[model samples]
Target: MFSTSNTLLYADKLTDFNMPMPHIYACHLSDQLIQFTGPDKKSYLHGQITQDVNLLTNDALLWAGQCDAKGKLWSILRLFNFQDDYFAITSKDEIENALAEFKKYAVFAKVDIEQNKNHQLVGLFGDDLSAVLSELEIILPTENNSTIDFKFGKAIKLDNNRLILCIDKKAQLPSCITLLESEQKWQSLSILAGEPKLNNQAIAEYVPQMVNLQAIGGISFKKGCYKGQETVARMKFLGKNKRAMYILEANTNKPFEATEVEQQLGENWRRAGKLIQTSFDIDTNRAYALAIMPNDLALDTLLRTKQENPISIEIKPLPYSLIEE
Candidate 1:
């Protein structure tokens, strides 16, 4: 039942997805959605993730995190209700290990988890979605975290300029919607949005709060006894967590590679943070990235890469407040 969409031809041999106009673009999210069904789905998941499972409804999506025993995240994903069942959408790099660990913890639960290959997610972005909405003939989601039904499957509005589609793999996309073959734009926008997404190499490296997950409404303090709840609650109450996710940008002459962020401490640079994701915008000719660093670091702090050809980078403010309260 799960398969790739043959209807979507690769425009890979063509130009890039970044159009001259800023927002008018669409690309495959390239993310995977895991389906959950059964009578006990709610009760079972309520005790497993950082978000309260009882909050899930047809009208909205909730950002959630599944963590390890020590409170480090296994993955951070978007959870939603499509029709009769629930779906958890995550990046492709996270699918294998996250799925394995997820199933391991569900052995006694009545809920069933599956990789729903019948569906695929499309990233829709533009200042004006009215024209695109008419082409698809779907209801538009009005607010953040809102969900709306479409011909293919379901849609979730991430913000005013962005929404995502989870459609049937066999369905044909409307000609009005220009679907991009590459997901690089999706990667850059997500970095600018400051939504923390982790790859396999970066998993289990930090607690959820260290990545500003709680700041973005991805964590619930009132949720009862989920896995690693103790560690999570302690971080908030004791003010023990000192790290946060930050958006960084730099004008570069060419593509740059960096694994860690370094601060200008006195004259010598020292390791300050880990770079989680990076993307280059063809239009702006600049590189953008997401890095986890000290929560109290001054904004626009001078930083660079540990690489030999170090690039100068500065922190940019996230769209959402990093404040916990």
Candidate 2:
């Protein structure tokens, strides 16, 4: 069920066949992986993300953003050091577009931007991840706050809600596979992580804060202005007013289309928000979805899908702080 080429590497690790299935998948990027070199490298990225790049040790993984002049997040990233080179991984949805955008700005900068889909990324999840790794005698990365180049398995908190064991695809290890979580679990977990994806439905609908990007270390207030900085800063200091994304859980059998309207709001069946991702509990058959809703909406807001088995949903608190400032 897995394929490898001369340019690729693959390994499987022990995992529980029962609890939260482990999934191994590559992080495909349309935008080339930009390797920044030279003395100006740190300053360049420090100007980009929410966290101070200068503060990041070689082993630190920083959560950052590439935003528009108005501060709308064009892309989200996690950057770390790899030897003398610095690597950044962004979302697949915006990779190509982001790459094109960066090329225009690169101008005379000393950076090498090349599509590095050649370097596959394999991830392991579940409460048993550490146990399985130990069984294989693999030395997992230490849980140090410092930034270190990772060679094999290392558990990092993607956010407050989920922990991930990240492995470089090119590394050799015991049999380890990526167990793709069901659509519902994946979405629910993502929402809990407070990490938002730029899907077709959520592509340009909201700004960075609407998805709580800055609150999760995705934006840097001290950094020089990149694209969309003004808007993001204004919203943070002034207020978001009435717009923000919310996560809710409800029950229904109706089929739901993310970003599409499925319920009546007022005058007509207006668009409330988009169903960004979803996963179902294999045992309960209950679907949990992640969605973007108006900030004023209630947690128990009623929602229905258009399918014959209309799906129901409920709002839940994201496992992060959503501060006004």
Candidate 3:
């Protein structure tokens, strides 16, 4: 278990981030784990989510979303299977709300839903992830989203370069693994990776496509009869979606919270989109934000903040292409 003293020690190490490669950090502060177990678990989830739940394997994790009848996202999460049950990792603030939403539909199903606080979510990043895990005698799934049982925990490969380690809260971390102090670094990394997550304020404000969920493998158009399936399917087939997620960077003295994104229309600034998530590197004075904006908007469209002191936005390339597949 990571104790109070351990946390302090980890915080101290964060001061000198120039440490050697193969970094590991506690990510539980920003994320929470929700578990679903029952005979009807798969079928129940398959009917309520946008991803094809039936395709989820014990070895892989799935990115999915739960949306309302109109297809607005309620929560976007990482789903995986462990110990004969299904577990989802989502923003901590949305855990209870998501649980409540899950229960509303799970009432008739045999599934049991509950928060699992016993596990701590940790992020492992660096080129030496495989080597470091090998040193700890941990074997992880090689394929992206795949998972494997490790010592008293589970290891999931979010991608080739990043892994999410879910360890028992009581388990002591290996000496080589260094815990990150601030979540800003992790958040920054996620933005660079173009992974869009939802917070309390942004819930029910975006459809999956608006956030580019389909481009990120979070949506499955072929899946049958999930909540909001009809609307989502129509958008997919009709290609009428006018908004999409984009990465924007700005020079700011401090981090910017989620807010409205505006485009300059001649002499006037008009509402063009909404900022979904952001991370600011204090040292660099650069703010990175993910916003949903008009897809057809010209690349030269001048975008700025809608607040009193507006910041200019510069478009940045996402790791993946936004073109619909």
Error of 2 at 264 (Å): 6.2
- The 10 consecutive residues of candidate 1 with the worst lDDT sum are 6-15
For lDDT, the strongest prediction is 1
Error of 2 at 72 (Å): 2.5
lDDT of 2 by residue, 95-114 (tens): 76556655665656665555
Q: How many backbone clashes can be found in candidate 1?
A: 0
* TM-score per candidate: 0.91, 0.75, 0.90
As a TM-score, model 1 comes out at: 0.91
Q: Worst 10-residue stretch by lDDT in candidate 2?
A: 7-16
Global CA lDDT of candidate 2, please?
A: 0.54
Model 3, 1-325: lDDT tens digits are: 5532234323432322234543444444568899999999999988888999977888878889889889888888889888888999998766777888889978898998899877878777654665568765777655776888777678888776677888887776665555556677667768777888876678988888888888878898777888888888888899878888888888888777538888988899889988888888766577888888888877777988788778888877777877876
Q: Could you tell me the lDDT of residue 100 within candidate 3?
A: 85
Give the Cα lDDT of each candidate: 0.79, 0.54, 0.78
Whole-model lDDT, candidate 1?
0.79
Q: Using alpha carbons, what is the TM-score of model 3?
A: 0.90
Candidate 3: residue 91 Cα off by (Å)? 1.0
Better structure of 2 and 3 per TM-score: 3
Model 1, residue pairs in steric clash: none
The all-Cα superposition gives candidate 3 an RMSD in Å to the true structure of 3.1
